[model samples]
Target: MKSVVANYMISRKWLLLALVILLILLPFVLSDFRVNLLGRYLAFAILVIGLDLLWGYMGVLSLGHGIFFGLGAYIMGIHLKMEASSGGLPDFMMWSGMTELPWFWTVLQHPVIAILAGIIVPMIIAVILGFFTFRNRIQDVYFTILTQALVMVTVTLLISRQDVTGGTNGLTGFSTIFGFSLSDPATQRVIYYVTLGCLVIILLICSRLINSLFGKALIAIRDGENRLRFSGYDTSMFKVLVFTISAGIAGLAGMLFVMQVGIISPTQIGIIPSIEMILWVAIGGRGTLIGPVIGAILTNSAKTFFSESYPDIWLYFLGAVFVIVVIFLPGGLMSLGKKLKRRNSNEKGQTNSKADYSAS
Candidate 1:
């Protein structure tokens, strides 16, 4: 049974099931601090899985995913700010001496609108970015550069628009979410469960997508976009669709993240964060759905552990991890088991051949 599971065979579905069960039970066993941290990591896992669909299956890398994530977070954060302020302008705005609420904030005052907009606004922006880039036949590293540029623009806007966005300080001081006190442990647990549900549902849908024809087209695009285009499929449209979807998924992850972290700042939405997100998918094994999820969680866990002790050099530690993974585990951590199993199988085959010759 051990070897069977170790072989990465079909029977390992039960192992996945067991892992999910463990995740579901975690909140009950762990303290609120640890559970909240897990919730944040799971939110990141959702974002990376979406990224895997793009970079892993569709053959395009985006470094501006933080923009979409930030949009969702800021939308949610703005709404919470309004709620905390009880229909008046947020404290930051008062500090900036603004007389009234901004036009955008006024519209998102309703909870339903805020939630829907949090998810949809990111998709809309993604659609625009996707259409402009993919339709123009801009490919590869150029597309990546555009995304990073988008990050720069976004971070700059958030910082410069101090009154509206809270500038470098970002948005915080949330008393309630939909009239429920955020300070309540029970409410926090509910948020955790909601985050977990989103992660699971997103993964399941992505898994289904990978098994569908659309997914096949994505893989084909990744392998050879021109060859697939020659086969009469609209390669650019497929890229746009996948990129848009990935952005929307990242936006959703950001929404969940803001709820747990209770702050959304320019720092979180900058170029560095987006690059770290890509590293999660790369280090996790991009081609597979499960790999990026594992990579995001593990990498974030390591970051938390290391950053607490050595805040200044933690980034260097992250760079070292990427280097090690690239050199020794090109397929990311997930492939390590498969590599070992294959080596052992080859050795066993050699032993069997020698025994057959001896018997002869």
Candidate 2:
């Protein structure tokens, strides 16, 4: 029976069913506020899973995922604003002294366009960035720094364009998504479920991608770039493709976040948040697909709990957790759990050995 359960977990369909069941039942068990917060975390998990594919599997450290996420949120925000205004100007535009919606905002009248842009804009940006970076054979610490630079550039641009991009304030007051009134509890729950559904879909796609030939190639590239290149792989193209896919996933996460939170801002896409994102991937265990999801959920849950209980020392707690994870369990929380179980097994083995010796 135990083996059967284990085998079921190893199957994607069963794993997905289990995840869906947990998510579906969560709202029943959790308070509205907590359920909503989990919705936000689910969005973050999507981004983390994508990052794990690139950084964990492909060894491509990206610090600009926040930019992609922010882009998607902003795109969705435009559509939400349009939905609220009914072909009029977003309130922020009026407040900023604009007589009419900007020309770029025109396309936002169509939800389909906004959704497509959310996916495409980030992908295009990533492809452009990857083209230059990968072509130059950038990797490791240098690539990380480049990604950080990308985040800084994006944050700076958004902050500088107050009238256009809402500057540091960014886009907000998104009162609706589609035809649904976001203020309604039913609509909010529906959005939450939609986010949960997206999470499950992304997880399955990621699992499949990681287990397929393409996934093997990515792992190979991570393990030995030179060998992969020698073996006739167009490594740069692979990097570009994977990077774009990662950015697009981040965009999807951003859209889900904006739907739940009703806001998008430069602060949310800044360097600090980018660093925190990498931490999610790290503390989750980079190479393992499930590690990032675990890390995001656990870290976010800890942050929520600690901030409410001891807001003054929450940063210290986060720091302490990072330090402990780094020092004792370099592979991450997942590895830490495995280590404890292994130690218990070793101790039990020793006890059994001693018992047998005594009997002899």
Candidate 3:
């Protein structure tokens, strides 16, 4: 038994190592377009892992992550827009007959400040939302509903406030970033690697977080919040912290995504995107950190492929795939390995028992 367990662990290590190597070599092996697509998916992976931490471990499902993601993307997009404007108002603003930048937009004029706000703004929003909701002990379905509602409200506001937010079009027309032309293929490849590096960093942080006592508390709250509270732990605080951290991570993903995608629109942050984010976590096997990453990549890749090949039916195809995964594999894709291992172990045990019976 010990030998078998040891071998399994070793195999897992080798598998992980191979995956890392594959990711590192992908840019070299694939076309620039494919590499960019994978890079965008990597950004989604970051978002889903954070969602897993919140919904999978902490037992809080938030459909409003799209808002935090949009906040970060918009913040970064605003910076790029400002730079593109070059000491003048953005094209959208000028077209709308605005003579000056909004005060909020002005705050993100500096690249460094924009980056900071890209991350920090989502966290601040999370803290405010988490504090109020968790403090009131409003969780589970109510929390989920509120998050979904927030997405609606946020998208509506952004669309309605066209002069400030670029309306339904969101923010685009980014020419350069940090003096590097975005249209340059070399610059794009560099961005792709940077995104991959960020994904690694976020994974490490989440892995460390889950292995710590805080992670245990999160699982505990997920399993039995009232019992944890009865034991004198501040469950609300734990919930709030996890939610805030996850929001910040989502924000970081947004910034990376905007760097590659070149657009941040209200349509992207609307209800459909929020639901898709949740599906990534669910289909990936939420509690397992790596599962969500895999889920995000696979699902988004499928979306890209289908949208390219079968644009008219891609949405239906994606929906059908998720439905199948949920109905048949509720434990998710990660659980398949465990199931197979368990079946093998059971077969071995039965064979041993039959041999003993014959000997008797």
Candidate 4:
């Protein structure tokens, strides 16, 4: 236990150093477009981490995370539109034949309410869904299918409501965020930094959370719910709590994503996008926290690169990457590190045994 703790401490310090270097150098090395791409990826990294908390560690395969993400994005998008119009209708609103903003749009005028909604809406939904689902002991692929259905239902609702949701076009033409002109390079950089800071903060929070007693309980449930239940732990409540945490984190990521991308649409919350989110965690390695973060960054970065280079073949390229990761790197990139560590440990043991044999 002492050795494990010490190794974790050292690894954390190293990861911290890596984050510092990336934040310092990334903006200068990348062009504005690339920086924006990275910003979006960083936001998704938060989402992946949140997904990892529930699906990766707790054995919950959620295909509905995109819905939570979209909810948060929509909240932030409304606020951006409100700030741009200064309490009037957004540009899309004008194009859609709406002369006046709705009553709900009034709350968006305040950034605080918008931000709170971004976090709270997802949490509320997750809590409600989780309460019934966990209470009924629904899990595994059954839970995943239900989640996918929820996303489909939400997307259908959003698409059907043309006036309020901007219909298929889905909320665009945002002017500012919290008084900062998003179009300005300075503002963009500030947003990027804020995103990086958020990624770091979420990483730390998750690390601590996973190491706590609550985290241990979730792992217990993940490994063997029957045993945990027998041991007097309320497995269902633990699952609900973890699920809610995952949803909140996804919401946070969604808010950051809308700020950078300047739009939120039904397409983002649809079934395909939700599956892609799972791919992000799967390709990165589900059980390891760091794996999801690395996976999101690499996969999204690759997507940007591929789309820019060969727009026609980017989807195929992404598909191939997913196939390759699933086949060869079942543990994700983080597993490679673990494999190397074990190999090194074995070599050291052999060397120590040989030295002792010689002394004897």
Candidate 5:
């Protein structure tokens, strides 16, 4: 089994290397607009990876990942808005009739604090949620429903707090980040590279984690939580740890997204987008690290193309794609590729065996 796994990795390594090369070359070859889109898609890819880790490995489906994502984005957004306003009220705040910066927003003026809060805040939320849910033995559909409710509550709160959160508009108009003008092409390129680097780092970390004994424990929990519990493991603790890590990763993705997209809104943190995040993981093989990245890029690219070409019919097309993937390609596109490769290898072996028999 180890040998087979090693061989599989060896076979896939070239493809991984090619992908890295393509990412590195994309900014150089594509127009600025296209590069920006790629950067945004990469951010989504990071979110999908975290979702895959949670749902695919641990069997803990969360439809509320957007809350963590939005929290992180808002943290960075607050910092950028504060910076842009030069320590005064953000534009939305002024428009909403705010006289002074909110006390909570003051400490986030420091970029370092904002970034740390972006990651740490989400993890803290995840820890609290996980503690309650897992301790109460919530799993499967109940857990999923709870997450859905969480997203709804978060969106409602953000939308209602017009003065504090900018309401429907959220936050935007970030001119510079840490002294670099966002409008500068060089700055955009640097941000794109930084996002790509972060994605790669997160992928590496997840890859190592999933291959470890802890990852095996996660799988065991996924397969049989009760059995694992009976085997003398603190399954709740594991669940909380994995869930917090997943939220932190999502938060990191949100920060990268805000840097590239320049806006963080409640709309993006709502139920539909959260569901789309799950589709990204499912359409890619969930258990596979690279699959979610491919799914995110392909699915979002398709959505962009279809929505541009046929805005009214894009939803039907997307629904059909989801249906077909669920019905026919249950293991996802990556699994299909693996199946084809194995079939071809088996056929070649059979042909070689026939030739040997003929020679004998």
Candidate 6:
């Protein structure tokens, strides 16, 4: 058992090294357009990692992560809009007949504050929602439904307050970030690099977390909540903490997404996108750190290709992919690699046993 564990750890280290090398080399190899697209996908990868942590490990399925993601995007969006406005009311607000910025918008003028708020606001919201729901022992489908409702409520609020949130049009017309012209290719590359760095940092944080005792508790809660509770652990608190942490991670992803995409619209924060986020995690092996990144990149690449080449049938293609993954690869696409490795290990073990017998 010890040898087996050691071998698995060694394999994981090699896999991690390979991933790091590929990511570092990708910018040099891919075209500017492709790199930008990858930046967007990496942001999505970050979002799905948080979702995987919650749903895959803690057994908490939240269909409303879009709310947290959008909130974070809007935080950055407001700052960009403010910068573009040049101390005047934002274009959307002016169009909506508002003479002044809203009180909340005033605070976002500072980029640092906005970025920090982008992460913290979602975490606070998650804590509040999780605290009440978990304390009440809302689990499984009911919890999922609640999260879906959160998406609806958030979308409605943003749309109704068009003057503040830019309404259905959402936030756009971002000219610069911290005085750097977004249109400049160099600036774009810098943003992409920053996004890549953030993803790497988030992956490291999650890896550390999942290997810790807290992670074991989360898995315990997933596998047997009642058993864990009977073991004298406050399962509710554990769930709430993990949920809040996941939301914070999603927020960070959203911030990076807005930077790369240069837009944050209500459409992106709706039920469909939220469901798609879940699908990314599902298609990737949940409970596996690297799986969500693979799922997001591959799934989005396919979506982009099909949407452009076969626009009318892209949805169908996506639906088929999800169905196939669910039915045939429930352990997700990553499981195939694991299986092959196990097979090779077993073959080597058999060869060693034969050699020993022959020696005897």
RMSD after CA superposition, every candidate: 5.6, 5.9, 5.2, 5.3, 5.5, 5.4
* Model 5: pairs clashing at backbone N, Cα or C within 3 Å: none
TM of each candidate vs. truth: 0.93, 0.90, 0.93, 0.91, 0.93, 0.93
Report every candidate's CA lDDT.
0.86, 0.83, 0.86, 0.83, 0.86, 0.86
Measured with C-alpha atoms, the lDDT of residue 216 in candidate 4 is 86
Per-residue lDDT for 1-360 in model 6, tens only? 578668867776687678767877898989988888988998899888888889888888999899999989999999888888876897778788999788878999998999999999999999999998999797667888999999999999999988889889899999999999887878878888888788888888988898899889988888888999999999999989988988998999999899888999999989999999988987877777788788888899988998889998988877897888777666677677665666797878843222110100
Clash count for candidate 2 is 0
Cα lDDT of model 3 by residue, 14-115, tens digit = 665676678899999899889989999999998998999998888788999999999999999999998888757998888898998889888888999999
TM-score of 6: 0.93
lDDT by residue (305-359, candidate 4, tens digit) is: 7777899898887788778877766677766776676679787884322211010
lDDT of 1 at 338: 66
Residue 262 CA displacement from its true place in model 2, Å = 0.8
The per-residue C-alpha lDDT of model 1 at residue 196 equals: 84
> Which is the better candidate, 1 or 2, if ranked by lDDT?
1
Candidate 1 residue-wise lDDT, 68-169, digit = tens: 999999999999999999999889999998998899999999999998898889889888988999897986789899999999998998999998999999
**Candidate 3 ranges with C-alpha deviation above 4 Å:** 1-13, 347-360
Number of clashes recorded per candidate: 0, 0, 0, 0, 0, 0
Candidate 6: RMSD to truth? 5.4
* Model 5: CA > 4 A from native: 341-360
Provide the clash count, candidate 5: 0
Model 2: runs farther than 4 Å from truth? 1-17, 344-360
- Residue 315 lDDT in candidate 5: 86
Worst 10 residues of 1 by lDDT: 351-360
Ten residues in a row with the worst lDDT in model 3?
351-360
